[model samples]
Structures are given as C-alpha cells and as structure tokens.
Target: MIEAQGLFKRYGDKTAVNGISFTVHPGRVTGFLGPNGAGKSTTMRMIVGLDTPSAGSVSVNGRRYAEHRAPLREVGALLEAKAFHTKRSAYNHLRAMAATHGIPNSRVNEVIEMTGLGPVAKKRVGGFSMGMGQRLGIAVAMLGDPQTVILDEPVNGLDPEGVQWIRHLARGLAAEGRTVFLSSHLMSEMAMTADHLIVIGRGRIIADAPVSEILAGRGQLRTRVRTDRPSDLLAALRGDGTTSTFLEPDLLEITGPDPRRIAEAALRQQVLVYELTPLQASLEEAYMELTASEVEYSSHDLSLGPPAQGVSEGSRS
Candidate 1:
C-alpha cells in the first residue's frame, strides 16, 4: 500500500503539491488523474524519492521508499520509459538492473519474455520505438516482483493491443493482493481498468473516491428521446430546469429531467414518442465537469483569417 499525508513539493517560488493526503490500499488499482501542470508528475516523483518533499511524508509498504534495504523488492516504479543507456541492448539493461539487487540471470530472461520483448531483446535501446521502450520500462518495473507497482503514463505510446495488455497486467497484479497506482490521460481506458481515482487540480486534491461514486455524483441523469414532433416535445418541457440538444430531425437528447418525467410531458402534449432511453454519464463527461474551472491552460477554437488576394483554397498548400 502507498500512503501520503500532507505531502508537499515546492520548486523555487512555485508549489507543485500542496498538502494532498490520500491512501492507496492493496488489492486494487488506483488511478491518478489531473490536467497539465496539475502536479501529478511531481507527486509521483516525490513518492519514489526522485524529488524530496518540501514538507510532509509518503511511504510505500509502511516504510519510506529509501529506507528499504532492497527498494526494488518493495516498490517497482516506471516513471520514465527512456531512463536506460542508449547503447545497451534491452536484455543487457535488465541484466544490469537485476545485478544491482543480486537478481539472477534467469530472472532477466523471464521478464524479457513476460513483457513481450524477447524478439527485440538484443536490440540497442536507442533504436527501439516508443512502444518498445514502454515495454522495456514495464519489464524493469516488474523484474523485482515488488509488492507495490507505480506507473506513470504506461500507455502513452502503446497501440490498442499493448494498451489492453497493460490493463490486464494492472488488474492481474491487484488480484494477487498487490497495490497498483497508475497515472494516465486516457479516461476511456482508465474507466475500464481502475477501481478508484485520485483527482488533483491546481496542486490540491479535488476528489478521492471510487469510480462509481464519482460518476454518479458528477453528472445528472439524461434521457434520449425520439418523437415525431421533436420541437413540440421540447416545448412541453419549457421550464423545470431542463435542457436539450437535437441529435436528428426526430431525435433529441434531453438533460435534467428523468425518463418518467419526459414520458409524461410527451404524453400530455400528444407528441407520439417512440424512444425514451436513459443515458448513463461517461467518465470523460464527469472529469470535464469536475475540472471545468480547475484547468490551468484553456484552449479555444482559433478564428480563421481571410485568405490573401492571390491565394485560393486548393493552392494554399
């Protein structure tokens, strides 16, 4: 298990983490989510002792990370995918890391196969692709068979199959009563893999709860309505704090009102409703709502400027 109490990190005049306290228990995967410049990476670094905390404390497996005689056996971290020697082969790199902890040569080969890097095990690290580098990083993290695993953006450069493989690996580790702490920007995949989430914004924790609870709390129940007279059905729900969007000529996505309320409104207006399906809120929607005002850098659509006199649409390139 990983525990942080009032953890804080400061860089000169800027503060990265500000008194954030949370616990990651064993036997489940906990996702770390935040926007850019939200202090997620700094927190992860502090957990592994990469950067010293300005104040407060964090521990892995009931002890500080540095206090462990064999640190790899206590916690395995993959914070950077390309932290290996540029000229060393994948197999050689693992052998070197395992040597530091007196791990056997057999274990090196085992991790090479476990991470699906056997085919390219003899290749130089500098020539490897981003996906291959990620696989190597994971291989090193699992080399020690640690009780707690901490991964930062493990799926950043992976393909669909690789992504699925990492997801399974995380869940499989948790099933064995190990702690899995993962950080990623892919909400769709995170929703499928994580049992709980720790959301941070502006150097402070905004939410720390189970996935189901956050989803249920962040978004309201919405109903998808299909009818012959779309505008008429909308008119029936004039007030009552309801909002809607026209998906098609005969279809509308109604928000705020429940299915029963929408059905009653349509029936009263004789709108001839054909479909009234309830839509569950997705993780992406819930995340957006939670971090709506917490985003440090907001992006807006760039307005297109007029073309030059001699430039045509097809000739611009």
Candidate 2:
C-alpha cells in the first residue's frame, strides 16, 4: 500500500517530476512505466526519502518512510544494484547492514539463500556479473522482509531465467498481500508481471488504471466479418454506432460492435456468415499510444493524429 499525491520535483528550471498521483495496492503488482527522463526514478527516490518532493507527499502504508519505526522492515527498496562496497563480501555487507537494526546474522544467511546467492555469499561483490549484482540487490531488498517492496529496473541486466524469476517473485510477494511496485521500460515484461499500470511522461502521469482499462482505452477493438453479402452486412452495421472499413471484397472490419451482433445481422439477412473474430490489442501498442507525444526523443513523424493516436485503433483479423 503506497500512495503518492500531487508529487512535484524541480531541478532548477527543469522539473523532473510534475504533479502526479497514483496508488500501489496490496495483493497486486503495479507497474511504473515511462520513457527516458520521464522522472520515474525521481518519483521512486522521493518515495524512499532519498529526495524530498517539492509539492506533495509520498506515504507507505499511511506513514512517511522517515517516520517508520523500522523503515527497512516497512519498505524495502532496490533502487540501485550492487550498492555495497565492492571489496566487501556479500555476506559481510549484509551482516553489517543487519547490525544497524539488530538483525541477526542468521537472517542475513537466509536472505542470501533466498536470493540464490549461496555459492557467492563469501565472494567479493566487485567481481560479480551484472546478473549477480541484480540478484544481490534483490537479496538485500528481501533482507528486511518489508511489507512493501519497490524495485526500479529490477530486470535491467538479468538473463531470461532471471527475468522470469523476478516476475514470479513480484507476483508471489503480491499474493502474500504485500505491496509490490516495479518500474521498467519493457512493455512486454510489464504486461506479464503487473495487474495495474501507472504510466508517466514528461514528469506527468498519462494513465493510472487497471491494466485492462489502459489497454481498452486505446480503442483498438476491430472485428473481421466474412460474409457472402458484404455490402448488406456493412450497410446493416454502418449507420448508428459502428465504423466499418472495407478492406477486401468480402471482408469488412467493424469497430464499436461485437462479433456476435455482426454474426446475428448476417444470419438474419440470409447471408452466409463465414467468420467473425475479435482482435486484441497489444500492451506495447497501448503504451506507445499514451506516451508518443511526451517522449523526449522524437525521430518518428509527429504529424499523426494527436501524436497519441499515431497507431489507429483499426484491428486486422
């Protein structure tokens, strides 16, 4: 359970994060997504007390991170991978951090094992690979067993298996009623790992809603209708609530109408209804539609409709 309200951050004249609000609910993974320089990291930093917001506040389980009795146990964050001293062994580094909060060495070992770093527990962190470093960061995040877990770019350098592991891990944490917030640029990963999505662009939130809602709002619902009497089928559904585009001789792509209705019209008109299928939109397409205008680097043509509707909601089946 994490809530951010009217968060604003400025660096001189440039605002890294504008007034944005979103909530990370328990028992589900909420994804934070945006293009580069979109202030995702800055927002996360403010949540963990690393940077104070200029306007609003961020709370974890109804309390600011700084006000928690044991902040580590209340919120565990993996903002950076391999943040420990390079020369120190992973076990020793964890042990040292555990000492600050009176956590036992046994807990340290448990976390080490939990993160699949047992073989490298005694090894120096400097020699660890990027994947290993990511694993170590996850280990440290779980060291305190916090109720809310915040991970920024958790799969930055992870291999395929490591990425899948992180997905499962995020889901498992949420299943336990813990708040899991993950930020990533990979749309496919977010599609698989998150139940809700919070998208930001130019330091402002573009969309904050359920994953299905965000995808549906992009309006890519198109159905392919194959019938003997294509003209009649098109005429029957074209008038009031539908937008039909004839692609081929016998194929009509219909939007704003369900497949069942299209089939019913064909059957009533004595037309042979060959096929009717609904098309689904990809998360990548939805994300691109939402952030196309706010992206900092724009090599693609922006003359398209609203920059956000460059990819029209026409489905091909």
Candidate 3:
C-alpha cells in the first residue's frame, strides 16, 4: 500500500500541494484524478522520493521509498516516459534498469513479451512512435515484478488497442494482489479502470472513496419521471418529503423520493405515469461539472457555448 500523510510541497511562495492525505490499497486499481496543475505530479514524485515534501511524508509498503530494501522489487513507477535516453534501444533501456537491482535478462524479456514490445525492443527509443514509447515505458516499470505499481498517464499517446491493453494489464496486476496507483486525466478511462477514486483539485483532496461511494457522494441523485399529467405529477411530488423540477412539459425530474414512492404518490393523485428512469450524471459530465472552475486553462469561451449547427467557431469535448 502507498500512504501520503499530510503531504505538502511548496516552491518559494507557491504551494503545490497542501497537506493532502490519502491511501492506495492492494488488490484494486486506485485512480488519482484532478485537473492539470493540481499537484498530482508533485505528489507522485514525493511518493517515489523524487521530491522531498516540505511538511509531511509518503511511504510505500510501510517504508519510505529510499529506505526500502530492494526498492525496485517493492515498487515500480513510470513517472515520465520521456526521461529515458532517446538513443537507447527499448530492450537496452530495460536492461540497464534491471541491472540496477541485479535483475536478469530473462525477467526483462518477460516484460517485453508482456508489454507486446518484442518486435520493437531492439529499436532505438528516439525513433519509436509515441504509442511504442509508452509500451516501452510500461515494460520498464514492470521489469522488477514489483508488488506496487505507479503509472502517470500511461495511455497518453496510446491507440485504442494500446489503451485496451493497458486496462487489461492494470486489472491483471491488481488481480495478483498488487497495489496499483495511477493518475489520468481521462474520466471515461477512470470510470472503466478504477475500483476506487481519489479526486484532487486546487492542491487539495476533494474526494477519496470507493468508486460507487465517490460518485454517490459527489452528486445529488435525481430520477426522470414522465407522466401524462406532468403538472399533477409535479404538484404531487412537491411536498414535505419530495422535490421536483420540470425538464419538459411531460417530464418532471424528481428527487428525494424513490420510484416506488413516487409511483404510489402519482397513482393516489390520479397522475397517469408512463416512464420513470433513474437519472445519473456520467462520470465525464460529473467530473467536468466538478472541476470546471478548477481548470487552469479555458479551451472554450464561456460566453459562447458553441457555434450553431454546421458552424465551427468552437467545439465542446
């Protein structure tokens, strides 16, 4: 497991991380999510002992990274794939890394196969495509067969196939009871890969819980209700224990009441009901809603939502 206890970092007058604490447990994928410049990279660096915290500390497997015996065998991380020597072959790069811990060639080859880099293992990293470079970086991280893995944006330049491969690899690693701590800007990826989520914003921990719990805790639950007499249904739903908002004349968005209860109320009030589908905000939509203000850069003009149909003034992702 990886633990950050009140971790803090500062550079001159700017605080990059502000006393945030969280844990990454074994046997599950723990996704670290935040907007860019939210201190994610800084926190990961501190965890791996690349940067010393100004106020607190982080430890992996109950020991500081520098103090670990056989550190490579305990934790493997791909913090920055671009940090590797560009002239070195992918295999040679892994070979050099393995040599640091006296790991053998066989293990290097195993990771090569596991990462689907056999064909390009002998190619110089400088000439490899971005996807290939990402694969090579992953291969190096897995070289030590460590119990804990940390990957930052592992799928940054990957294709659909490569992304799928990484999803499977992360899941497989966790299935072996290893701790997987990763950070990604992709909400769809997080929704699919993570069993738990740690959401950070403005250098602060916003939410840390199981995926279901985080989603539930992050937003208010609303149910979509369609009835023949939408006005009556709205009136019936707005009471001591219920709240309703109108989305359309025939559809009323209701909350604070279960479907069964709403149905009973509608039936008792002679409101003909047709549809009642629970509404949930997609992870992407929820994340955008949560971090909209936290984003450091604005890609679109807020005043201009988007261009009209067949127009190209701005686009929304």
Q: Highest lDDT: which candidate?
A: 1
What's the C-alpha lDDT at position 149 in model 2? 98
What value of lDDT does candidate 2 attain over all alpha carbons? Answer: 0.87
Question: What tens digits encode model 3's per-residue C-alpha lDDT throughout 1-317?
Answer: 99999999999998889999998999999999988778888998898899999998899999999998788889988886666799999889999999999999999999999989999889889998888888887888888899999998898999999999889989999999999998988889999999998988768887788888767755566788888898777677677566777888888888777788788888899887889988786888778877766664446554676533322222213
Over 1-317, each residue of candidate 1 has an lDDT whose tens digit, in order, gives 99999999989998889899999999999999888777888888998899999999999988999999999888899986899998999999999999999989999999999999999999999999999999999999998999999999899899999999999999999999999999876677779899999988778898899999999897787899999998988888989889998899888999999999899988899889989999989999888887767666555334554433322333212
* Candidate 2 local Cα displacement, residue 242, angstroms: 2.1
Please provide, for model 2 over 112-148, each residue's C-alpha lDDT reduced to its tens digit, 9 standing for 90 to 100. 8888999998999999998999898888888788999
Superposed Cα deviation of residue 220, candidate 3 (Å): 3.9
> Lowest-lDDT window of 10 residues in candidate 2?
308-317
What value of lDDT does candidate 3 attain over all alpha carbons? Answer: 0.85
The lDDT of each candidate is: 0.89, 0.87, 0.85
By lDDT, the better pick of 1 and 2 is: 1
In candidate 1, the residue pairs with backbone N, CA or C atoms under 3 Å apart (3 or more residues apart, or in different chains) clash, namely none
